[model samples]
Target: MYVALFESSHGAVLQPLDESGLATGEARDVGASGLAAAVAELEAGHPRWVWDDTSRWYPRLLAEGVRIERCVDLRLSHAILRNSALTASSTLARSAASSWDRAAPETVELTADAALFDFDGPAQLNSAEDTLAEFALQRAAIAGAADPARLGLLLAAESAGALVAAEILYAGLPWREDVHDAILARHLGPRPAPGVRPAKLQAVLERLREALDAPTLNPDSPPELLKALARAGLIVRSTRSWELKKLTHPSIEPLLEYKKLARLLSANGWHWLDTNVRHGRFHPEYVPGGVVTGRWASKGGGGALQLPKQIRSAVVADPGWKLVVADASQLEPRILAALSGDRGMAEAGAAGDLYAGIVASGAVATRDQAKVAMLGAMYGATTGESGRLMPALTRAYPRAIGLVETAARAGEKGEIVSTRLGRSSPPPGPVWRTSQSEAYGEGATDADVSRARGQARSWGRFTRNFVVQGSAAEWALCWMATLRGTLDELGDGAWLTDSPHLVFFMHDEVVVHCPADAAASVEAAVRESAAQAGRLLFGAAPVTFPLTVAVVDDYGQAK
Candidate 1:
């Protein structure tokens, strides 16, 4: 069952849709004030709600204490169908860019995804008729797709991700402002006033000045720092940390320390606390499908995804609750094994350490070499130790290695490569095509050939990893979506905050904020969902995804 919802001038409109996406009943009118109640009433039947964008609708519903079990985010689905190779022959993909293609809604600041008020964009398409038309096109595209099952799964997983992102936003991650402040103070001394460096940072800055013997040098300015270093017999191109680290100077250690502390101050300092955290929780704005490879990204200077490990100690559970942290072990490598049907690699991975498995197979002398070789294969590493061990790794796992090699060759020829579930890579842009074309022109120079060849190889590297990374992302979606449903069955499971709920999600890691008593159940659910996700993506491919799970009072202990 499905309910296609649209923004109505009077308030909102809901149309019942069957499995085929055809309307099964008349449109039901809902006032803006009564929207949440109306949604709750219909949610009782557990229909998969269809809407223009989950970002625009789900956040508001979640804010009003109304939670939904399933949804089809038309905006996200449109993106998939319009770009997927499986649906290339459909009218939806063949048509010119329409309003649906450019419909990211006007977002609120702190209430980022909570788009309660109506604001019109140039290409807004929220009418019931417009929504229905767009949805019908999506259905047609999926039905006409060469591999409808995989495409449909991709769409469903993408939409579910939208829901998960909104829910996490609404629920907010447990954060202790006081704990964050303590961590900062311990690293950088007391919090300084605006534009004033903390005591510890000031000490490092002074040391940098002394080491260069330039009393007036401002280390904060890159040009001044470079000139100072040059004048001190440390000639370097830039003040970048990596270049500076290679040099043996009294300034190097202090400079690196300064940079690290400065980053910590700027990214997660008192200002971050003032803006991000509220009432003991931090609400991070998540943009689903933010990465082209289908990974989630945070918005609005919160730096949620990039939360430095130094401040992880601040992520504390509530008094009577625990944070259940679970991360998949060797996710991408296992994904590669499953995708290629490499029985040997699969067997190696069963030991819970694929690299160890490679070493055990006599492919390499140690786990480190196996890791480097495997990373080289997946990431197109063609030099150094990785290159040296390539033949050995290849002999041990030919199918897995061959798969990435094939992807790399296809990419060099500017051909598109799809993930295991059919999320195709976008074609090269005009500049890339032009570069390759010019390299083959009659008057082409060696420089042109070299540049074009390098670019092709670089793009090949991207594609080689794209298949593995993108498919791994899909597996993550399935794991999270299934875990979400399982967690929904815990406790009352109706009011999101009352039950065990997901509070954070990294690429392959998830943190569930659960009551003390339900921690064990949530842990089991996390592992069970991982297994289920493996089966869903591979369908008995003999690859197992194991997770390292821990129930801790704070986030840092889980690691």
Candidate 2:
């Protein structure tokens, strides 16, 4: 009989055993007989089951069945089994599939959730539907919804927006939701009253026909498009519900269209997502190191984590589900506190808000100005309005500015910058050096060269922020690993299987898609993770970090 040793599936090593069921440490000593004779001797001693790659076992067994070994010592291997009968193997494989499905965590399962069934709604559809619907509605309401095609677009937009908002509220991290909401509050005071519930998507012709003379109107484009535009800071709403205007530069409209295309792509994405959801629950995969700049990336679908208000309405909860949302208050500024070890900054964060500190510091007249100034400083945006307003900020928070500026300068020199925790960015490529020299090269004395040099200088400022942003990403990664471990201990039985899993992550934000029943646990898990993340990133440091959380029934509310 032919014999071969097979490796265990779990990667364990097996050794020979004696008749007494004890390890015979001397297999190498009797090796003159080679592996075959040694195996026979081991069978005489006691049948020893050795773990090795299964490739070894399959070949020898294919020729003939191996002689029986009497070794009592053995280990269990969980390899996929093949039966004599084809029908039997198929049944075994089916059973294995069911077992894996049942044991898979909610986060992992979301990858498969998007496909199974169609829960078509504002939250579930693409940006085109919501934007088109809202545009049609607004045109009808304001411009009289006279144009059927435009009106159709508006209503479609609204429907899509509402559905997307529902999904976001259901999946996003608390701090991420807070940042989104803050951006919304900056422009739209509060969410518009829930306008219309989403139903099955209408045929294109019928939608166009209905929009022709629709009575109701809303100015906002479809939710998905609006979200893409808002993130790029292109659109803002006026006081009236039906009044909306574009804020971003017209030159960037192509970029806007690209975003729209992305939104459109999300339609197919939504379909794929639903199909992937195991059973009835969709779980979008959350990639921890997804963003190049330390933000979260969605594996199965890109739920809009970067977008602004109104669009959030597109993300909706499923049937029999309510969104439980929470967001952190002033997360970045608070992170700065822990990073710099500045007592004043920490105190400012501890006192509820950071803009208030800027006001108290006499940095700016209102919180809005403070926001523009601080953001401008970090981004190194100095030429436009934000740049003009930056002096006062640099004067007040010299250290903050100093930190970014110093890093920016080092980056211009093509050097790596490190955060407090020792995480460093990758080295600048050769392109950076060539670009820097070309801009400031003595050979080029024209005005264009000077401008180029200035632009390069500006890029240096951006590099400074990249260091901070990138390091912040590392902190997020550490937090994710820690939280995953903690939640695993909660045991599978204690948690709902179809609940929200980690669907998306952005720098300093995380999105969890869970069922309504698990929202409480989700919130607790986030808060605990944030706390734990702080400890891990800043040990023994006197810093206080607080996350602003809001539980919303809709993504719009969370926004």
Candidate 3:
């Protein structure tokens, strides 16, 4: 059963729908403050809530102490169905663009005491009638899809992801500001006054200037620093750390050190601490389906995705809790194995480290060679050691290597490729199309042909990775969704906000904050979720998705 909730002019309205998504009753108004109670009552029937945006509606509901088992997030569902190649023949997929296609509304972080619903901000799904119509279209689109079951699973996983994102935000990650400050003080000296550089950074700057024999050099100015390096007879193209590392100079070490510290200060320094973290929690605004590959992105917080290893100590669990950190091991390569049905590669994945398995298969003598060769296969690498090792890898794992090669060749011909579940790569831009046309058309120069080939290979790299990355993202969504349900069931008598729950998710990693007593159960759940996700996608294929699960008191200790 589905219960659609929509914001109305007077208040909130709920309309019941049968399993087939047909309306069974007229809309009934539930006044603004009455939403929680209304939803609480509806919860007895275990109906899936259909709403415009999960980020907008679910957060407020969670704040009101209301948690629903399932939801059909219309905004997220529309995005997936509209762009999915599997749904191309559906009316909703071909429908003219509307406000629904717009990116989900920016999430507003609300304090617990703030108003539950802010109607005056902007009208979104303000009419039960419009919300119902959108839901119907989405259902019809799924029904008419080429592989409706697969697309339906994708949509369900995607919508569940939105709910998880909102809940993660509300729950917030456990953070220890004291630990963060101490880590900063140890590396950067004491926090300086506002607008002033830290003592350690200033000291490193001095050392850099002295070693380069340019007393007045401003390390922050790229052009000035580049000029100083040239003046010091270090003729490098750029000051990127990789290039700097190749050169042996007294200043190189300090310059690299200075850059590293600067990044930490600028990205997660004192100002970041004061602004983002509060009440022992770091509430990063998670944007679900933000990345084109379907990975989640974050906004309005310290580099959530790019948190530095040095500061990871700050991610301490609450006193009575444990952080259940688990990351899928070699996720993408394993995904490629399952996607291509490469029995050899799948067997490799089923064993421990896929690269080690490749070595054992005699594809390469060294693990590193196997690593680069597999990476080259997935990423379109065709140079030096990677290229040299590729043939062996291909000979050993023909199905896996051939799958990506076919994708690369298709991309080189300017054809779009779709992911396993049917997210198609966008066509090349007009400039690229024109360049290819000019290269092969009436008259062409060698330079024109060369440039076009280069462009094609570049695009090929993108498309080759897109399929594996996107499908891995789908697997991750299923993993998280399955784990979420498992955790909910484990903590049946307790509210999600007050019980063991997910607090953070990176691409292949997830951190669950749970009571110490439930730590073992959570670890089991994480491992079980990975197995379930693999089965959900590949259907008993030999490929195995293994997770490195760590139950620790601090996030840094997990690894």
Indicate which candidate wins on lDDT.
1
Residues 415-455, model 2: lDDT tens digits: 65554333333344455456557766667667757665664
lDDT values, one for every candidate: 0.86, 0.44, 0.84
Worst 10 residues of 3 by lDDT: 108-117
Model 3, range 368-480, lDDT digits (tens) per residue? 99889988888888999999998899899999888898887887777777676666655566677788889987779899999888887877776787788889999999999
Better of 1 and 3 by lDDT: 1
Each model's Cα RMSD: 4.9, 21.4, 5.7
* Worst lDDT 10-window in candidate 2: 71-80
- How many clashing pairs per prediction, in order? 0, 99, 0
What ranking emerges by TM-score with the best candidate at the front? 1, 3, 2
Which of the two candidates, 2 or 3, achieves a greater TM-score against the reference? 3
Q: Which of 2 and 3 is the better model by lDDT?
A: 3
Identify the runs in model 1 with alpha carbons over 4 angstroms from their true place.
102-125, 235-240
What TM-score, over all chains together, does every model reach? 0.94, 0.51, 0.94
